[model samples]
Target: MTRSAPRSQAAELELPGLVRDRVREGRAKAAATRARRHAEAEIAEESPVARVLVDVPLAHLDRPFDYAVPVAMAADARPGVRVKVRFAGQDVDGFLLARTTQTTHQGRLQPLRRVVSAEPVLSPKIADLAAEVAERYAGTRADVLRLAVPPRHATTEKEPSPPAGPAEPWTVSVAASAWAGHDPAEAYLHHLADGGSPRAVWQAAAGSVWPLLLAHAVAATAASGRGALVVVPDGKDVARLDAALRQVLGEGRHVALTADAGPARRYRDFLAVSRGAVKVAVGTRAAAFAPVHDLGLVALWDDGDDALAEPRAPYPHAREVLLLRAEREGAAALVGGFARTVEADHLVRAGWAHQIRPTRALARERLTVAIAGASDFDLERDPFARVSRVPREAHETIRAGVATGPVLLQTPRRGYAAALACETCRAPARCGACRGPLHLTGATTPPECGWCGRVEEAWTCAACGGRGLRAPVLGDARTAEELGRIFPGVPVVTSSGERVRASVPDRPAIVVATPGAEPVAERGYAAVLLLDTWLLLGRPDLRTDEEALRRWSNAVGLVRPGGRALAVGDPALPALQALLRWDQPGFARREAEARAEAHLPPASRLATITGEAGAVDDALTLLALPAGGEVLGPVPHEGGRDSEEWRAVVRAPRAHATALSSALGELQRVRSARKLDPVRVQVDPPSL
Candidate 1:
């Protein structure tokens, strides 16, 4: 699984209907009450409100512990304030989610030493959501809150300057006059500012440069006298969105919320949002909590990306955050993306938002194709069935495309050299010291395994007597090497990460890139050799087909009309037919139906129970009931002799997920009474 990097910043807050009349009355009454109580004792106010900070270290036991509220700073101790409180005799940070006349304290309570900041960090909504996330993920509230609210950025402070970024163009799906029809994206922008009440989601396609789309929407919403929040996938997306927002919304009117900003800068942005200095909030995942006076709409881009899922404790996702906030605050939510998730599709199916999309037929006019597969079409098929290698038919396409422009080779892995096998034996050579797969570093050097730091000497081929080896599972380097050899006179540029080509203009050269790393051709690629299509299409996971289609669509989108795109695969499959006809939307609809029939994700919520084989069995046996559905897998682990973990899956209606989750939490609590917590609950996991 792709573990996404943390965003620059994000936060959660729940604002009560705090009004002017209430603040004044509450303050005056609190002040008078404090004065009367202080007259007699310096020891302690017998029943003073102690703003206790508690974290749910354990999911079922997510209750706040008792703490003392010192008298000197009573007025400043508002809910959402972080303070140093002594818990278990050690000072720990806690957010005051709420205050009450009492706490269930049998032991003596410790007084809060100092309020961390006068500014409020925890919103009541976020605080509640933090607890909710804990319950759902079977994790401690404290753990969830730690990720939801990092310690340092929670404080109120100002910074000298904002961070800088590289000049990478945002990913955008340029459409024709779908804009001539009033440009819902642009109109949505206008309504954001004219808001009397808040709520709405601006649905869009994948690769639509949503940061820019959202910035426009926010600026429009702000212009209409409402605040808007734009949440995207990562820091890179944040930069593009932030820049676009500043350009359109104007600098002073907007604030960027991301973890990448320095502590002081983040605090400043938070304060600006809290104080309503910024009407348009543009940020990464954490920016969902836009502290605006009156929210207009909450826009989340690429809602499907795992980056939207919080990684800390509770593992709450941004889509849920946006949903809850939108529901509670009446803010419009626009969960836009280039590619639609089944969850997103469900939202449209449920009438949450009208499903939006780019016209593929129109898109196809600009798209061209050249497909080769395992049929009469294939000239030279791979022995191992890897598509990325240079097959003879691929050679023909490349030669033709190269004469006009560059040829692109897309592979799965990125490396100089990926696989190594004994030349004589053909079996994967291993280091005797560590049992790890060995790599051949140099002709004279010993083979080493990366896993155990183990090296092997006199390590001859197991199958044959050959001491040397060859790369079996080909990588970008191998492809580049072969391409270099085939077209020796041509300049071969390899793109992977930071040094990748910004744009792939029309050029007579071979560009080799790993998936997701392929740059757009400046003019256009003469041909795209989609190698290893089967490896991508045939993954064991349910998403294999959907994911493979996405890869194909993205590549096709970059191809110029009448340009060549040869996808080498089992042409007999319908996926190939769909590609031949450019029928992505049709294919997606069909795949969704199949998944629904199979009771898979997007159709039913999935709760995966994984642990040691024995532990999983015991836990599954204990889960007697799931409110909305049936239990699915206590299935065996696939691949490898040492794969000891087994899994049990629970599939329930999307509506029943919470109740089922709650039941699991309750079961966990009951089990805790009998034994330690055994099963873990992960909701809407990226994959099973």
Candidate 2:
């Protein structure tokens, strides 16, 4: 049998084991190739782990999330880039906060879906500021980021910054002149130049000189090789500051960042500042967070204007933001206005900031003020002629004052009739459909509901059955019309809202404008008529008197040194006296003292919680307030019809403010985690 088996039989017997070995070798090689491919892909992904802040905008999800960077997106997905990521189960947009080799998140991370742009729209400074702002305002960082950074313009971001221009040093003489008697302001400038962070509140005169003073401050900061940020209330302030900065700091040292300059242009200017191409940044409220490098000084013009308050969830005021920036960056702070705010006064009272003022005699010599209705003047004869909107004294003053320059008339409203009431019963006219108050936008436009925006042709008063309407608040247009008739052949111009003029010719024209819309005359206005003092002072707002004083002071600032201003209001009012005497510091001191006594803001901290009645009540109950804090309301919200929403206020001592903020933040987190209905929480709100 062995002989028959031969060589062929022996080879067949060894074939199974050899074939098995060959199959094992092939399988091993395939496994090795798969491992190598995986290692290569992971090296591409894991090397660049991006910490992205997804734009989910939830309080619970406020922090940055980690994402693995894909191979193709490694270059574009660098820090601060806008990118799209897979959050949860869907794609979401986010800002790439940073890149790191590791993440604390233990779970497997999702990869970035795609890169939106390589342009690092957000700088580290900006991201930090936004986060600080969000914390201070009790808001989600995502919301604050939305306000700090404008929408990304692909075309604009790719474009290069304009070439460098001639370098002309800004003059400091304006600063010296404006701060001549106000030693604190001068010292503030010196401190900035010496690279010291000095915080101050300057009660600068309202007119042309204030802009010059601000420009001087900026120039001083620039002298120290540092940057400056100037935030105002509106575009007009931007233009005014721009002109003054150019005059004092020379051309091309600063860029005006305003929304009025289309998005593309605004983003371009922003990029310039971010890239250190420019040193000075000037713009409206949002510009407080401008990406300025080595910021030396942060200044705000008319910080009390409502325009400075962000109209979004977790509202923040420009003044507070600047204050925060000053603290965070160790930069000098300058908060100046014609009239001082209680908050600013508090800073001086606390010794956190010093007040800069002109000598009483110097201030008196700079501007003259008179009370129109203070004296025993005939309502229908001497000061106020029948059917005439302008008082006779105002008319006379304008007649003589126009010889020197322009005369400014400041009105409270800016249409044919702002508010209407029944002629018989003095009941407000409202729309029949919505029961909203009616207003007249123009002489041609019928009475329209201010809330619902519907024409009330057949409207009837609820309190009175009468239909004849009378103007409760006479507007600028009507005032101009009546003035035009009174002063025949004299040119009358109106400025308000969209039609605001930046500057007026230094001629003998009668300029009528709404608050904050007054045009700067080449030479100061000859006379300023502060009309409708009652209308402004009679508002139910806490800052009514303060705001009125501010408006009056602003108008007074427009007048030449020897020129006069006539205010048509009760002279006995402390605010009116403050304006008449050019006593901003005294007013602020008194205001701060009074607010302290009343346990109001600037002395104490306040937070507002608003939402559906049940939600707000539930949230209030859940709050574990600090020892000195008090919760005051479950009251119906103002300006709502059949509103289910209610508001509750939390008042705390300034010392305990931090604790209160922390408690509120925790409450927000709990609610968010529990998936409960959201409540709107506003700390230091504009109106509240």
Give the per-residue lDDT of model 1 (tens digit) for 1-688: 9875444211112224455456668779999988855642232454455555464354444566555665666666788888777666677677776656776777666666667776676777667766666666655667766655544553345333242222222211221222322234434444444563433333333223445456655655555657777787777567667677766555566777888887777777777666555566777776765555677778887676767877654457888777777776787778765455666666766777654444555444444555665553333543544433556788888888889887887876566545577665668777666667776444455657868866766677656678776666566766777788898787677777565664656778888877666776756677777777776765787677766766665555455545777787777777777677665546666877888888876777777776777777777777756666787767775644477767777878867777777766666666666665465566667765
lDDT of 1 at 113: 62
C-alpha RMSD by candidate, in order: 13.4, 7.3
> Mind giving the per-residue lDDT tens digits that candidate 2 earns over 196-229?
8888888875444788788888888888889999
Q: Which ranges in model 2 have alpha carbons more than 4 Å from their true place?
A: 1-40, 44-48, 70-72, 170-174, 206-208, 374-389, 419-472, 639-641
What is the lDDT of every predicted structure here?
0.64, 0.82
TM-score of 1: 0.78
Q: State TM-scores per candidate.
A: 0.78, 0.88
Model 1 has a clash total of 50
